[model samples]
Target: MDPNIQGGSYDNPSQAACAHGHYGVAKLLLERGADPFSQGGRFTNALQAALFSESEAIVKLLLEKGVDPNPGNTLQVVAYYGFEAIVTLLLDDGADLNIQDKTHRNALHEAAMQGSEAIVNLLLERGTDPNIQGGAFGSALQAATYHNREAIVKLLLEKGADPNFQDVQGGLFGNALQAAALRGSGSIVKLLLEKGVDPNVQGGRYGNAITAAACNNCWWDDGREVVTRLLLDYGAILSDAP
Candidate 1:
């Protein structure tokens, strides 16, 4: 039996300490060479563990121990969860804002989907591409629209996000307008329409927003009527002749 317990469950002692916010124990483990940058765990590493522990002290200690901040979507995780302090600390510690996760979504996309206006604005201010298209919802505007995050949608639009941007990689929602219509975001739908979204533009199963609303299957009853009227107001052609 070794004094440094490293031969048990996948949960290492150092990681456990960090996750539980036991700062002194974590320091002891690191003194015993417990690999602060250990790869592959629930939180990925001690820094991530500390970050999720909601302890600024632990996070600061890990950073002092030279833990890398941008390891495998850590920044994305913080941004998605709207961990403002954690995001601010990571950014100060040199986390790469443009690092893409498994879904090819960057921090901006995650922030947008989660309706995190503060984090989204911070990312944008730090130079995230507003029109970066590759995630599950294509552009950040499309992501915000899919999740019906109207505030984020408005912010993205104001920052010059493309409304017509299509999710060619994901392919389910297509452009921001179609995605909003399918999910029944009348406000978001109205915003995109006001921004000049071509209603007849073809994409997704419904072909167009008018058809998406008329189908009455993809959307719920909550805002279906409002979206339909809004689309009609924006000059959506019901015939689908395009």
Candidate 2:
């Protein structure tokens, strides 16, 4: 224990215990009237620090003691590290599955953005909206597609994510097919194509996935060839006009 926190307020003891994964010290502090939710210094609280450290034991202890697992800091840490176990614990404890962060990104969005397939599946199993939007980058599908997470994309598709859904920007910017093409994820593109994603769906500066791939130079050689052939096979029209 740090000398500064040894004799400090109840908040300090719990915070220090959480930081160091001192479950016994944390329990002691809580038993001695420490508020597990207290925030001080750089530490948001015992629960937040435990989640940050990926200390499953400490997190379970805090949850058992009734800490707010849905607190912004707790959610942030869970989302940042893709802690599938902690996420499950928090959900079982009734953490808000749709609680958004400062940027309006919920835990689902975070998991998808990081391409954590396990976390994504867990969130979806718990009824998290696959199409929840409002992140800096938009929906969870957009995050997965942009990152070229083919597994996540396939999972989201299986879970009924709207591949044709647009973002809050009022355009088709977040379309899964467009993102896959933009990133040169040919496998994802092929999956989307097979799923009946419109071959000519207009999005961003380009009119469709093929155009987007062509314009963004997503495929240098064989990637371009595959994308073009796939689009042509799907009846995508190519024109000289902008």
Q: Candidate 1's error at 93, in angstroms?
A: 1.6
Index of the highest-TM-score prediction:
1
Evaluate model 1: give its lDDT: 0.80
lDDT of 2: 0.75
Over the stretch 1-242, how does candidate 2's per-residue lDDT look in tens digits?
A: 34235345324777777877888877887877777767664565677778656788889998998888787646645865888888888889999888887767778877887888898999898898888776765788877887778788889989989878766564335577777776777888888788888888775645567777776445444466677777779777787315
Cα-based lDDT at residue 123, candidate 2: 86
Count of backbone collisions in candidate 1: 0
Give lDDT: candidate 2, residue 113: 78
TM-score of each predicted structure versus truth: 0.89, 0.85
Candidate 2 regions with alpha-carbon error over 4 angstroms? 1-11, 170-172, 205-207, 216-222, 240-242
Q: Write the per-residue lDDT of candidate 1 for residues 60-157, one digit (tens) a residue.
A: 77887898887888888888888888898889899898899887878998899898999999988888889987677778887888888999998888
